[model samples]
Target: MQNMGGIFGILGVGCGLYIFYALYKLKSTGDITSSILLPKDVNPKTCKDKDGYIKAVAPKMAILGISTIIYGLMDLCETFVMSTGNFFWIVLVLVFVVLIWFSVTVSKLNKTYF
Candidate 1:
């Protein structure tokens, strides 16, 4: 109905703002506050340190981006799919838990190194 347009607008703005904030923090704090939390898909050798440690930022950002999109997708799906009981709640919880864990783990690991 009329609310769908408003909801779409809000989600678009929210996604844009989240990206803007993350990018700004990356520049100002030198820390990517948000990254994709995903299993690496590349060759292990490609991701490494001097000792060949498998670590990278792209994957994290990709995961984060995917998660954000999923949240919106699921939110919309709820209206059509009665099986998806209140997607917003699940998405909200997942977002908070995943982001908190990801941010903390990344920051702690960073401190241990440089």
Candidate 2:
């Protein structure tokens, strides 16, 4: 029941950290040759400026990672501290908004640089 939420929260945090780590690697290595951020049809070889693209997209990914961590904390709170009421719905909506924003921004970045 409510305890299940703790598991999900931990998983979310793990995922967020992993994403953050990936971005760090991309930034440090400047390796755009094989990036998950690149779209399927958008070839990295055709990118106008790989560094510029990463600079633009990395912040967006960071935002997404931070949002996921926040969502995870909220979920954990819902499981242990508070009851499943208004807060749950609000967090759910916020998660959706962040996800949609991330997707749209990434697509736009792909078009802008790739």
Candidate 3:
């Protein structure tokens, strides 16, 4: 179980870094028309200012990615040092909360931007 936490931490960090890199590339190129980050059916050309739209959304993606990395670190710490039963429940609850928050954020982004 503890090993799982470490694995998740590594995976989360890797995913977060990848997201950051992708967003950075999008920002640098000022091209929002065709990006892996956007939804499949979303046409960036529909937006009035594609560059501005990308610029606005990139920060949100960065924040989400950073939060994921932080959650992974917290999970790793909980696994190593807080394995008591009560602490376990607390961590589980925290995980659920994070999941819900992340889902809501993504949904909102989709609704607002995509």
- Give the alpha-carbon lDDT of every model: 0.51, 0.79, 0.64
> In angstroms, how far off is 90's CA in candidate 3?
7.6
Q: Give lDDT tens digits, candidate 2, residues 6-96.
A: 9988877786887788788879986663444775666667889878988898888888788888878878888888876887778768878
Candidate 3: stretches off by over 4 Å:
3-5, 33-36, 43-47, 80-114
Using all chains and alpha carbons, the TM-scores for the candidates as numbered come to 0.46, 0.80, 0.61
Model 2: residue 27 alpha-carbon error in angstroms: 1.7
RMSDs, each prediction? 9.6, 2.5, 4.1
What TM-score, to 2 decimals, does candidate 1 have?
A: 0.46
Clashes of each: 7, 0, 0
lDDT of 1 by residue, 1-114 (tens): 335743753583467457556645554554434243222443322322412111444345445555666666666565455446565678767866766865676555444433
Global Cα lDDT for candidate 3: 0.64
By lDDT, is 2 or 3 better?
A: 2
Model 2 backbone overlap count:
0
For model 3, residues 1-114, the per-residue Cα lDDT tens digits are 775757876776676677678777768876652443556787765666666567666776676667666656666666676645665456456655755765576556556765
Query: How many angstroms is residue 46 displaced in model 1 relative to the true structure, after the best TM-score fit?
Result: 22
Better of 1 and 2 by TM-score: 2
Task: Quote the RMSD, in angstroms, for model 3.
Answer: 4.1
Off by over 4 Å in 2: 1-5, 32-36, 40-46
What is residue 73's positional error in candidate 1, in angstroms?
Answer: 1.8
